[model samples]
Target: MTYCVGLLLETGIVMLSDTRTNAGFDNVACYRKMFVFETTGERVVAILTAGNLSVTQTVIAKLRQAIARDDPEHSIMRAPSMLDVAEIIGRTLNDVHVAVNERMERTKYSASASMLVAGQRLGGQLRLFLVYEEGNFIEATDDTPYLQIGEHKYGKPILDRVVTPETTIEVGRKAVLISMDSTMRSNLSVGMPLDLLTIRRGEYRVSTRERIEAGDPTFSAMSEAWGNALRDGFLSLPG
Candidate 1:
């Protein structure tokens, strides 16, 4: 399991994902779930994946291979717009899932993965999409300027209450980190270090990419502040 969240704001897009993959109580490891592709001032794409590790890795590898070929029809780098990029990713994820599941059928194992894809191309509007296992996706809209996957329930409340299409990128970053912090406290399957990426409107490139590891002072301070605020609010409620 994992927790990945992406916020779409007027200023830009903010995305974050944890790096923990647990096969069982005794088998736990860290693997980055965030992948970014960009050509400065031309285009930028970021993918946050969650679900079966093998399926997700294979899907990413295939996407990379397609880009290496520089084939406009199959490469996300050559996709005309962010919408097209999302479609390509959706189709690839679905194909990989089917192929892997077929190979694992006799063993009774399941292979499935979902992803949050967001980016922009030169002269195109910034877009964010949630791609499901069925080769279909939904785009983020003004009414709901965010998308989440994996153990999303634990981190959704803050986003619902604090995020908005008009929010600034700086505030958006803090909001997402708080959202991740909430999930980390409640779920053991999602842990540090975390990958965070930010893209500003009109830049056509990723402006910030960070990794927040365990014991990181800035994140730790934010987490503590949020906890204290929650307690204070609870205490102020009439009983």
Candidate 2:
């Protein structure tokens, strides 16, 4: 399993995903779950994937193939707006899931995948979407300016408490890292290194992209601070 989250804020968008993929206790490997595409000042998009690795990888490969064609109608880079991009991704994911599952049917194995899409076009608003395996998707709204996929329950509480449309990019980044830390502590299937991406509104390009390795000092310090704060908060409550 994996854990991926995207935050839609007034200033921009923030996304994070872990790299761990596990088939069993002894069969663990690292594979990046974040993919980004951009034409630098014109358009930018980021995808965070979760679920069956085969399905997710095929979906990404097909999307890249479409982009390589430069077909305005089919390429996410040429899609009119973020909504169109989401639709394209949803369709691709659904198609890939069906094909992979059919191939696996002979062995009674099944494959499925989901993704979180976030991006902005040259003249469009920043948007975030959660795409399901069935070619359907929902966008993040002002009421709930964040979307998450995989091993999400353990990390959701921090997002619910700290994320909002008004959140600053800095705060949103911290919130997501803390959320990931919480999930990692509670779930063995999710591990590091992590991919973090931030795209500021109107830039139509990634403003920051960082890979948090297992022993990254800054992330380590942040994680420690968060744990300490949580413990202090719990102790402060009246008994």
| Index of the highest-TM-score prediction | 1
Identify the runs in model 1 with alpha carbons over 4 angstroms from their true place: none
Give model 1's TM-score versus the native structure. 0.98
> For candidate 1, lDDT tens digit of each residue in 1-239?
89999999999999999999999868899999999999999999999999999999999999999999997887999999898999999999999999989999999779778999999999999999999999999999999999999999989999999999999999999999999998998999999999999999999999999998899999999899999999999999997
Point out the worst 10-residue segment of candidate 1 by lDDT.
104-113
Model 2 lDDT per residue over 34-86, tens place: 99999999999999999999899989998999999997777999899889999
How far residue 112's Cα lies from its native spot in candidate 1, in Å, is 1.7
Q: In model 1, which residue pairs have backbone atoms overlapping below 3 Å?
A: none
Clashing pairs in 2: none
